[model samples]
Target chain A: MNVMYFAWVRERIGVPQETVETEAATVNDLIAELKTREDRYAAAFADISALRVALDQELSDFDAPLAGVREVAFFPPMTGG
Target chain B: MQVRVQSEPFDAGAELNGFAQGRTDIGAVVSFTGVVRDTDGTLQEMLIEHYPGMTTSAITKIVEEAVSRWTLADALVIHRHGPLKPGEPIMMVATAAAHRAAAFAAADFLMDYLKSRAPFWKKEITDQGADWVAAKDEDEDALNRW
Candidate 1:
């Protein structure tokens, strides 16, 4: 699966997107898996409250199932307009 | 309905003039243009980032919802990304309807949704540094009013 990060999360993670292989069932589970990889991932995933998730380009909750999701995105709350 | 997510600047006036033009059915056309506002004098530019694949789809979905909710003859949304100077246009929403009230309401509805619900992110660049603009609770609250 492809995991994308945007805005400050991208800055914090030091990358825009990456490919990861995981058995995680939900968005939160994926975040938890990534958190154990490195300090940067841990720091970025430390506070999930400040982030928003999108599953396959649609806004989704942290606990959303990722059964068939090809891509997942994490970012701060949108400040568009 | 039309939704455009581009990196280049757009002419709001020309867009409004062309949208639903010469349509006798549409009597009222309401437009709202959002400009890059610099809160302090030290601001240099505003950088907008968006999900390429999701931006158009999300905007189109919003426009479709507006069309279904109102008696809209037509609707248009143009949002620009990349770096934009102060006072430059960021986005514009236009709605056309048989009466002023419907047009006005639909335009307002689109603006509110675009403000917080859209996938775009805004970063303010100033002499100090660049920082991502945080979403405000009021912006989220504004959506609930409709």
Candidate 2:
């Protein structure tokens, strides 16, 4: 699966884009997998409380299933105006 | 008919006039311009940063959704990224409709969605230090209530 990051989320994680191999079934499961990679990934996701996720460009909840999703993007909550 | 995400500031009146030109059916033109403000009530500067490709697509989606929900004749949205100073324009949304109500509502809806759903991030450089403005839950809740 392909994962993308944006803004400071990219900076913190040290990469803008990455292809991940996972057996995760949900967005939360994917997060768990990324958190296991390194300290940067762990810290970037340490406060998932402040993060938001989008599956295939549609805003989704953390618990949303990613069973058939092809892309997952993680970023901070939107501040655009 | 145009949606732009750039680093240059925009002129609301000029853009509105340009969009309204040669249009006989556009009776109402409504626009909203968002400006940077000093956090302390004093004149402080602000800086905005955003993802390149994602910002444009995100805002374009918001405009498309608004147009589908309303009977708008035209809509223009321009959002500036990179660094910005105090009182400088950060974003603008202009909507044209047959009546003022639809134009006004569409413009407001665009702004609401932009604040809560767009992909831009802002960093404020204060006397203390540089701080990235976190997305507020209140902003999200406001969108939810709509």
Best by DockQ: 1
DockQ of all candidates, in order?
0.92, 0.66
**Displacement of the residue B105 alpha carbon in candidate 2, Å:** 1.4
Q: Can you give the lDDT of residue B29 in candidate 1?
A: 95
Give iRMSD, candidate 1.
Answer: 0.6
lDDT by residue for model 1 over B21-134, one digit each (tens)? 889987899999999988788889999999997899989999999998997999999999999999999999999999999999999999999988899999989999989899
lDDT of 2 at A40: 92
Taking chain A by itself, what TM-score does each prediction score?
A: 0.97, 0.95
- Tens digits of per-residue lDDT for model 2, B1-146: 67999898788878877986788997898889998988696445566766564677888888988887887888999999888888899989899999999998899889889998887878888777777788877887777755
Clashes of 2: 0
Candidate 2 TM-score on chain B: 0.92
Candidate 2 ranges beyond 4 A from true positions: A65-70, B41-45
Which number leads on lDDT? 1
Off by over 4 Å in 1: none
Report the Cα lDDT for residue B120, model 1: 94
- What are the per-residue Cα lDDT tens digits for candidate 1 across A18-56? 999999999989999999999999998889999999999
